[model samples]
Target: MNGTDLLALLPEGWRRVPLKATCNFFVSNVDKHSFDDELPVRLCNYTDVYKNDRVSPDMELMAATATPQEIERFHLEVGDVVITKDSESWNDIAVPAYVEGTADDFVCGYHLAFIRPRKEVLDGRFLFRCLQSRPVALQLELEATGVTRYGLPKDSIGLAVLSLPPLPAQVRIANYLDGEIARIDGLIAEKERMLGLLEEKRAALISRVVTRGLDPNAPLKPSDQDWLGEVPAHWEVQPIKYLAVVGNGSTPSVENASYWSDDGYPWLNSSVVNEPLVIKASRFVTETALKECHLPKIQPPAVLVGITGQGRTRALSSLLGIEATINQHLAFIKPHCDALHPGYLCHWLGHAYAFLRSDSDGAGSTKGAITCEQLANMRIPVPPTGEQLEICAHIRKSLDVAEPLQSEIQNSLNLLMERRAALITAAVTGQIPLEELQP
Candidate 1:
C-alpha cells in the first residue's frame, strides 16, 4: 500500500474502465414541486462532500414537494456514486461521493449527477474516490468551456474512464482505508490543536513585548493612549511619521489594455497583503502600466498595509523582500530600520492594528482611510533600543516554535487526505478484499 501508485496497487484480474461503460446514468431534471412535510430522503449537494472525503448530511437541503415516484427512477442504490456537475470555481466543480442508506433515493438539484454501477463491473466507493483525485481534476479542467472561468462540465465526466477492481478486493481496500484514514485524521486534529495554541502563544508574546518590554520586572506606568492603557515607565509614545514613511499606489489606463498581459511588473493589492507577511500577490502589471501611472516600485518586506478598503480585514500589513507596486487601497510604510528595529515595529504595528485602523480619518464611508497628517499623529509606544531588540528576539523565538507547529498541522492533514484518496483508489480498483473487511 505504501510503495505503489494506485494503479500498481490493484489486485489481479481487475480492469480499468471509463465511467461511461459500466454504470447507468442516474439523473433527474427540475420539475414542478410541492412541500409541506419534511422529505424522508436525505438530500445531498457538492458541499455535502468535503475535500477531506467526509460526507455531511447537514449540507442537505430538502424539497418536500419533490416527486418521490419520479425520484425512484434516479434512486441511489447503496454504493452508487454521486457527483456535482457545476461549482463556483473549477477546483470545487466536481465532487464524487459514495451513497449509503436512504440517501440513495433522495432528490438532488440540477447540479448533481449520480452513477449506479453494474454489480459485475465496478465498486461504487472506489469510483467516487477516483473522481476526486488530482488526475480526475486535471481531466475535468480540460473539459471546462466557460469564457470567464473553467468548470467541471457533465459532458467531460460522461466520457471519463477509471480502473475497476474485483468486488472482494474493493471491500478490503475500503475497510483498510477507513481504519488508516481514521488514525491519520486523529493525528492531524492534534497537530491543528497544537498550531492554534502556538498562534495564541505568539500573539501573547508580542503583546507582552510591545507593552512590558523584555523586563517583566521593569517599572510600569499608565499609558496615555486610550487603548494601550499602560506601558513601561521608560517607554515613550511617538507618532508613526517620525518612525516611518507611507506611500499610496495608482492604476494606469485600462481602455488601451496593452499592459494587461501575464508577463509584466508584479502588482500587489490590499487583498494580497491580507495574509501575514504578505508573501504573494495574485496579479501582475506591465512596466508600461507602472510608468503610465507614475507609481514607484515599493520596496518589499517594508510592512505594506491596507488603509482604505476591505472593511476590518487583518494582515493589512505584510513584511516583504521583493520589489512590487501596490493599489490605491493600500499604504506602503517604510520603517526607519536602522534606528527603529524593523521587526519590533512590525510586531508593535500588528498589536495596535485594530486601534490605529479605527483612528484613521477617512470620510464616513465604510472603508476608513487616514491622511498623512492623521498617520503622523498615530502614536506607538517606543521602548528603548536595547529593550526593543529584546522584545524582537523573544518574538523571533516564539515564531520559531509556532511556525513549525503550524507546518506539521498542515502536513498531517495532507497525509490523511492523501491516504483517504489512496483508499478510494484502491477500493474501486479491487486492491483489497471485501470479505476480509470486518464491518
Candidate 2:
C-alpha cells in the first residue's frame, strides 16, 4: 500500500490494483538434479531470467530432471513472466524476464517464480515494463527479508500494487518503448565496443615498450621462444628464481573467534591483484592466527600475482605497496632490487599474462591454477637496472596521456544507462503522454 500512494496522482483514465488481481503467480521448486525416476527437461534458470529481458527456446538452458507435476504447474507460455524471487542482495529481488516463446519441456527452475497474466486485465509486455520501474522495485526491495540471503514471500509479491492504464494505452506505450529502447541499446553497445578498443590500445603500448625498450633502433637477438621472439641483444634471459625469491601465503582459520579482530594485521586475498598496486587489505587477522596458521608476512616492494581463480584474475599481477600477508592463491615475488626493480618486474609480468595462464595449464597443475614452484622456474628478459627505471617512467607517462580519454568514454556510458532507466520509468508511470508518441 505504501508504494501505491503515488498512484493516487495517476491520470484520470488509469487505476491502481494489486498485481495478484491481474495475474496468477507461483513460486517454483524445481531443482537442477537429474534423478533417474524423473523426466528430463530444460530449465529456465535464475541467470536466464536476471541477465535477459526475454526468454525464448533458442537460448542455451540447463538440462535437469523435474516431476510431471512440476512440469504441469510451472510450464512457461509466451505471455508469462519469470522473476528472480531470491538473491544474496535484497535490491536484486524480482528481476523479471518475459517469455517470448515456448517449448514443451521448458519449466521454471529454483529461486524464480512464474507469473501468468489474466490476459483480459493485464498485458504481459506492459506488466514487465511496470516491474522494471523504480516504484515497483522499491516495494519489492523493502519487502525482501533475510540475513545473508533475501527472499520474497508469496504474500508480499501478491500484495504489490501498481497503476495501470487501459489495455489500448498499455499496448501503445509498450510499442513506443520497444522501438526507443532498442535504439538506445544499440548506441550503448557501440560505445562499449569503443571503450574496449581503447583499453586494448593502451595495453599494446605498454607491451611494446617493455619488450622492445625505449630505443626502437636497438640491436635485437633471438630469445628462442615463440612468445618472446626477440629481445635487445644486451639484455640477458634468466629464470625468475635466479633474480627474486618466489613464495606464497595461507589464510588464517576463520572459524576460530580469536582469528579475527577489529584492528589487526593486514590480510589480503587474490582479488587485490586486480589493482595495479595494492596498498590496503580487505580484512584483518589477529596475531595469534598469523602464528598458528603459519601465514608469511610479505614486505613492500614485492609483486603479487593471482595464481588461481575461477575468473580472469589468474596470472594478473600487482605491486605490493604495503606490508601485508596474502592468501594461498597469490604468489609473492620479492625481487632482488639491486638487479630487478619491482616496478619493472610488475610491468613485465603483466605483459607475460597470456603465457603464464597457458604455462599453468601445461604444467599439469589444477586447471587455471599456478604453483609457486612453476613460477620460480619461469624465465624473463632482464634489462640493465637504469633501462628498467627508464621504461617504468615511460609507461607512466603514456598512461597519464591515455587516462583522460578513457574517463570520457566511461562517463558517456554512464549517461546512456541513466537515460535508459529514466525513459522506462516515465513511460510506465504515465508521466509521458501517449499523444507525444504520435510521430
Best by TM-score: 2
lDDT per residue, candidate 2, 162-243, as tens digits? 7889999988888888888889999998889999998788779878877889998999998877898899999988888999
152-232 per-residue lDDT for model 1 (tens digits): 555567677666666666555556666765676787677677778877777778887898887778898887777888888
Residue 234 displacement (Å), model 1: 4.8
lDDT values for all models? 0.65, 0.87
List TM-score per model, in order. 0.59, 0.69
lDDT of 1: 0.65
RMSD of each: 8.3, 5.5
